[model samples]
Target chain A: MADETTPRLRIAVVGTGLIGGSILLRLHEAGNDVLGWDPQPAARAAAARRRVPFNDRLDVTLKGRDVVFLCGPLRALPESLTEVARLADDGCVITDVGSTKAEIADHAARLGLADRFIPGHPMAGTEKAGLDSAIGSLYDSAPWVLCPSSTDALPGFRLLTRLIIENFGARVVPMEPRAHDAVVALSSHIPHILAGALAGAAAGSAVKQAVLALAAGSFKDGTRVAGTPSSRTADMLISNRAAVVAQLDLVRAVLDGLVASLADADDAELLRRLQVGRGLREELLDRSMLPVTRSFDLARDDQAELDFLRRLGGDGGYVTGQETDATTVTYTALATR
Target chain B: MADETTPRLRIAVVGTGLIGGSILLRLHEAGNDVLGWDPQPAARAAAARRRVPFNDRLDVTLKGRDVVFLCGPLRALPESLTEVARLADDGCVITDVGSTKAEIADHAARLGLADRFIPGHPMAGTEKAGLDSAIGSLYDSAPWVLCPSSTDALPGFRLLTRLIIENFGARVVPMEPRAHDAVVALSSHIPHILAGALAGAAAGSAVKQAVLALAAGSFKDGTRVAGTPSSRTADMLISNRAAVVAQLDLVRAVLDGLVASLADADDAELLRRLQVGRGLREELLDRSMLPVTRSFDLARDDQAELDFLRRLGGDGGYVTGQETDATTVTYTALATR
Candidate 1:
């Protein structure tokens, strides 16, 4: 029986980069004894410098740890998990922070670690990765989805979830692994892929620099995820091939609908589509729940000056009299709708 | 032959909407004799109450004005320009702030008023529209693209350009009407359409309210253009159908290439694409010359944070230090190289 207050559980964190290192940091911050291991020498060095307890040997890192978190690219997770299951102490719990969990979970089960492995994805990250990127508060207020297989060890699963919520201050949501993968493919993966593609096409041209010069906030925001390392991105696409492809198909269908509307000269339909899009975009803005990091400010104090111009044009427009201060301008409704 | 020091010329602006109202306010602020004309009874009343010279009849407003600026949706521009061209004195110069130039210019030329009409598009606007949305410095330092036919009256074109620069503090760049249409299609029209389409697809099935809640800065910027009126967007797309279609095709080709890369599972190629995108996005942020408006602060600050996060996760590990009162973050060169 695990003691609630004096829990003597050991944890192993593999591939100690941004996500892994962050897990380790947060775990340590919570007073947990953790062992860190990575195949890359730099990563191992990084863990040591950051005072993350490091073992160069994976087997040594997993020898006594009660739980092992596989925090690597989606493609790398399966092999790493397999290695841990083969060499680690019997009954050690394993989980992952990979974006796509369905395939990883399936691979873990195939590698005979299903009963001990729980597929979990922390829905938080910066475009940046690596050991130095790790922070104690990375998972604070973020959603961490736990996808458990039917045959998974119950006590181990519950313990992992409890640790995530209590230690990391994260909200744990349970869902089917495949469903988690699909949702992320639509919300996160596809958008990143598209942004990268758009940027790549623009950059490969003769006027590449000029094209970038003309880019605005929209392009920057839409393509922010494209700045992530290619290896990580590639691993995501390859591992989550089925889900990403499905999302792309949906995107293509939507594009075709738009093309049809344009081709049919259906302005009303096109306008409707635009209106729906605008409404949806506005809704998204209001929620602030998604992982998007930007915000839109619509109010400008100088708006009255514009209204005053319209009035001067003899259109019988009224300017709002709310000038709070020099740097701040506010316009009230001239005539109520 | 126009004298530089001639007392501010009388200008009549029709529409009293965002563009027209702004121009009128700017002209009046510059000490020009400006009058606004709008058919909407409420609009005319509002303008009159604001002490602006308001006239409901276009003919009365156009009678003595030395210039008439058509500022409205594209659908309204051709008729407004035609009306002014028919009524205004032969010497009166006419211009517009419409998005498409070729169609408007062609209509003017066919109407035998090409010399009097200098098609212009001021590359400045907010997501908001209508007279209430107008602001004094709307066109300040913004690019005003001028499309003047070769055989058109040169003096009239020059006069229009001068007025744009002097009255609104905008810089005018002259180009052919077709070229202007094409460029705007790539820069403005295509972006708007893509934004609308993406928002439409992403808004799928998620509760309208929930979707809005989760939206962050990127979604807002990406969908900023979608907030524009459906009629205006429809007109823009329909009026510049050929060019827009071409741009859409280009965008599709880019997407196709990305899909192919993903299918091939080429990690190297994928990384190259992402790096290229990152470089382009960064360059664009640095090179953008547009005025800082409402969206500027939010985007700039968010971008700075993202950059900070990226450097922390970069190949060159982070070096955290204190700089005076601020916590400074720096990246050191990778040990591998």
Candidate 2:
């Protein structure tokens, strides 16, 4: 494996699905020499078609690679990493794009690659999945969570983290593996459950036609992730069951409160519950979490920027950057509250 | 009140809020003489500022109007319509923009105004509300549900319906008041509950910061409606309590199944649940329940139109008008799965 002196990193993407393929494509665009491997013949062929430096043999792909990213599904990651450990060169940093981190980290630790394995979860996805949905810029401006098995002081982990943040243009954030799992359970997994349940309820209803007819922007956007491939969604849910269940319990409590308010015709209580949700959303927006960056020089205040700011729908937007004489206005349309 | 011979209809909007103000603005732009009334001094002043022909006195606004629209909250609609009934000129149709229809229809019947009351709910809203959020094109291509107490033969009701469909450009669908309530409970109420609960759960979580940071597009869209003012949402929920509760039960059952699937680590069950939701969403898109009209001539084969049809997200789109060289293509991006 090349040392820090090497200018271009050698990267191996272990699966050419949505997350894996997108990562490879993006890293390749960022000047990394990326090799890809997917067990499925069609998937590998598709990656090859996209000119993703495909290698049929996983062992061959791993050899001499600076880092091997096990970008397989949650259920398959443990075994995939095991194979990576067996085949990959020593001193090479290992990472993953798994949804849940604790189990993956434990598996890496048991395989004697704990310190080298930085469990990463890019907080980015689309309703679509697989190679067909892979885009080179998917991870740009996305939050990439890294839960290092050891400390970030580890050279290999730090180098890999820097590469992801700098090359991929992702905002790298550090957290404990358990904390990552728990937070995503509330933010990602439970929302999927909510969407799936809504779609299921509507699908199962006698008024299915009407429900479909009336489903508007809110319903569609809210339930968009429910359309993700079933296998992938299931893997994430089951692998992260404890956290998701904890979030579900909270969801049920909130729902029960709403139901009680409805039953009692307590408008005030219902209003309070709704207000609490709205206030939380506003707080989320003001916190500047998940911002969409918009940059423009103050000398030429673009009408598009103004319109974007004015029409900034959802929670609202967070406007940052000061007005120096030659000020470049950089704003992120964050948790638009 | 003017008859069919009148060049422009004189319309009185009883509430100068989002729905009412938008309707007034749009109708005024469509050449209707639109007058607005609101008990709130601020709302009245705002409407007047927008040149909404604000009349603080309801009777003054309704004196000679062809139609009186009681555009207020579900809770206030009964009283608003009662006031409209007392003031509106003889033979003038009365309608409402309340989310729930059954209770309002009953109230109208009790007040001896059912024959002239066409209970309506335009299935269009944004998280923003009040006079400030009012826009002229808000109802364009949106579904305007009408639960007419009397049949279409009623002159006043038919005239108002025609004006809404032809002038406001909203798709007018006739439905029974109870049926409308039942359908919307599934389509609108349950989705709001899902959004609010998700936002509330995320907000109440220990990892609110991380949840906000990691929140993606689906989560944002899924929880968008939760940003709506608490009072308004509570009113909608309470007025449609029975239907909302029924829908909530369905939601609970679906959620329980998903929970069980996760607990058992039953990948197949989880996949089936996700697929069911996906399939329902697909069916919704295919049905073209919510549609926007787009037209193009066949003589010029529009690449954009073709791309729109092929790349039509969700369940796909409906294509109409054959290639007779003189034919025009029309499509709607509805129920995007």
- Candidate 1, residues B53-146, lDDT tens digits: the string is 7687888888877888888778888888878888888888888988888999899889988777888777777767667767889987665666
Candidate 2 per-residue lDDT over residues B45-140, each given as its tens digit: 687677767877877889988788888777777877777788788778888898888998888788877778888888787766788789998877
Q: Kindly list the per-residue Cα lDDT of model 2 for residues A1-337, writing each as its tens digit.
A: 2234445678899988889989888877766788888898888768767776788888888889888878867788898888888888887888888888999888888887877888888878776667767999888877777665553224454466567756677766556688788878877788888889988988888767666766667678767777777777777888888888877888889988878887777777888888878887786566644556666665555554444443332122322321222455444434332
| lDDT, each prediction | 0.65, 0.73
Top model by lDDT, which number? 2
Clashes within 3 Å, all models in order: 27, 7
Docking class of 1: incorrect
RMSD of 1: 17.6
TM-score of model 1 (first chain only): 0.77
DockQ scores of all models, one per candidate: 0.16, 0.29
How many backbone overlaps does candidate 1 show? 27
In model 2, the clashing pairs are: A222-B222, A292-A333, A315-A336, A315-A337, A316-A336, A316-A337, B314-B337
Tell how far residue B231 is off in model 2, in angstroms: 1.0
Worst 10 residues of 2 chain B by lDDT: B316-325
